[model samples]
Target: MRFEIQFSGHENIRSNHQKTIEITKESHLTPQGDCIVGVNASASCADLPRELKDKLKNSDSKITFSISVENYEFIIKGNGHQDLILTHEEDIVIRKSDFICPRTLAVKCDKASDLLPREMVELLRNPNTKGVFSITID
Candidate 1:
């Protein structure tokens, strides 16, 4: 199963968090939101399809998450958990800490925002940059 969320870059996209990466439906970002890579997200946890939501609740389900912008792309491997709420209305988060919450999309992620390539992070500092967030599971 797969789906994609569209988003745009922001001026405050520092992409410097060590344990999590997030996308939010809010169009504005503050400097303290270092983990948020994209703003004006096209979707959120509450917007996920029922099929994908089911898969994300299964402990055995694995997810491949990707963030692509211009010519740069980063991939993260993660897993679902029974504890996932997947109901946050505004945000979706990929976590490296195995934590599950309403905003958590997938846990045990291989990379957080801080691990992204600096070049890619640089491009994301432009508010006009377009980006895609994709999730796939088999």
Candidate 2:
């Protein structure tokens, strides 16, 4: 399925409009019995919390996110790190090549009932977290 993910935040953080990703049951399933959906794009360093930006520059840090879809909710936690590729643009693009920086949480649930690929993207777009940018679906 295909879905568009948008990021919104304050002026300091450059928010990305709509980014798209495709998910499939066969491709997303992991050996640990989890479904993994990820998108890699860059966001402006300024968009990140001052502490988080500093931490990424110096070392890796754990970032947590809460995702909810209809009646299902799950938490995805992953390490955030600095991207080596510096961009001339102002926004930070979470690239598929990089596994860190705003990656979605690996969801653990009954895939058949809890979430579809499109629903997974919807959950990420509307996460229940503060300070971090809000996401919208389109």
RMSD of each: 0.7, 13.1
Number of the top TM-score candidate: 1
Q: Per-residue lDDT of 107-137 in model 1, one digit per residue for the tens? A: 9988999998988888888989999999999
Q: In model 1, which residue pairs have backbone atoms overlapping below 3 Å?
A: none
lDDT values for all models: 0.94, 0.31
Q: TM-score of each candidate? A: 0.98, 0.31
Candidate 2, residues 1-138, lDDT tens digits: the string is 112233321112111222312122121223232222322222433344444445443324544343344464444343344443322223333222334333321111112213334443444443231122222211
Pick by lDDT: which candidate is best?
1
Q: Which residue window of length 10 is worst by lDDT in model 1?
A: 116-125
Model 1, residue 9: distance off in Å is 0.4
For model 2, state the Cα shift of residue 126 in Å: 12
> Which stretches of model 1 miss by more than 4 angstroms?
none
Query: Candidate 1: deviation at residue 55, Å?
Result: 0.3
CA error at residue 92 for candidate 2, angstroms: 4.1
